[model samples]
Target: MERSVEMVVALLGIVHAGAAWLPLDPELPAARLAFLIEDADAKVTLTQAQWLSRLPVGHQAWTLDALPQASAFEPISVQANDLAYVLYTSGSTGQPKGVMNEHGALMNRLHWMQDA
Candidate 1:
């Protein structure tokens, strides 16, 4: 994973073959990453082995260099209706409701733009 957030690693594992979880730092606390690691129940983690010694005492860690190369894989065949992304904007309620879109809906919107 690119970031130390465990969800990113877990999601990557689900989405990719030969996936390995790795943590990076932006001067962020290791504790935050550690929580993510534990929550994800990741058996092995990738980091500099040197930094592994510096990690909090119970978590398992490994060097990124030791990880195997990612498998050669085809990209996902996502339809336009598939989720593009969600934008969160604050409103009256504390929680945000997702606005879903389908490929046809987006295409129709684009067609209008072109005609304009």
Candidate 2:
């Protein structure tokens, strides 16, 4: 949370573990946060201890500080078609829409950006 190193590591860890990460900005309203959690059907939520109590119900909260550090990690196979992450639209018009991005698509976009 708070755009720190732990947040980066958590995002990478989630995808590396073959799980799609749905990042919820803590600054957003409580109703929006609850809506996102409900729509995503998220199971575990990794966040900082300070923000733990703020999260809406329905997630098994795991504080980033509690997570192991540089622990032995085994890389899992992730296919190009596999889900990479789910990002929500700004919802300026109405309810935010979840955009499911696959690994292949994300990589392609990144490569394109690099070329540009």
Candidate 3:
């Protein structure tokens, strides 16, 4: 929920699971969060128990505290064109807009940033 090691781990888990990470800050209004969750079609949100009540209707959550034991981690085929993540704008003009970043483009930028 809050900035914690578990949050970071969950992020990496999402990346490994070949899913785009759409972080919904707890501080954001519930309405905004609901909109994002719905827009992203978020089937399962990784969150802590404290934030469960904050999630609106049509939302499902997976609490990190009750994580099941894992036996193995298998890799998935992730293409360069695959979506890396989605971030929403501030919605100064209207409702926030989702900006999608593909793996290839994100990696290209990261490589460039390292070289810069």
The lDDT leader among the candidates is 3
Clash pairs of candidate 2? Answer: none
List TM-score per model, in order.
0.35, 0.84, 0.86
Query: In candidate 1, residue 11 scores what lDDT?
Result: 40
lDDT of 2 by residue, 1-116 (tens): 57888788888778778888888888878788888888988877788888876788656888876965657778889999998988899989998999989999988998999999
Task: Please identify model 1 stretches exceeding 4 Å from their true place.
Answer: 1-17, 20-26, 65-116
Given candidate 3, what's the lDDT at residue 83? 93
Model 3: CA > 4 A from native? 68-73
Global lDDT scores for all candidate models: 0.51, 0.84, 0.86
lDDT by residue (1-116, candidate 1, tens digit) is 33556545554553343333333342446665554455445576556555665455776665555756668766665465554323233334753343444445656787999999
TM-score of 3: 0.86
lDDT by residue (3-112, candidate 3, tens digit) is 89999899888878888888789888889889999997777888999998899966778799887677787889999999988889999999899998888997899899
Query: Residue 57 error for model 1, in Å?
Result: 1.7
lDDT ranking, best first: 3, 2, 1
Report the Cα lDDT for candidate 3.
Answer: 0.86
What C-alpha root-mean-square deviation, in Å, does candidate 1 show against the real structure? Answer: 9.3
The per-prediction CA RMSD against the true structure, in angstroms, equals 9.3, 2.4, 1.9
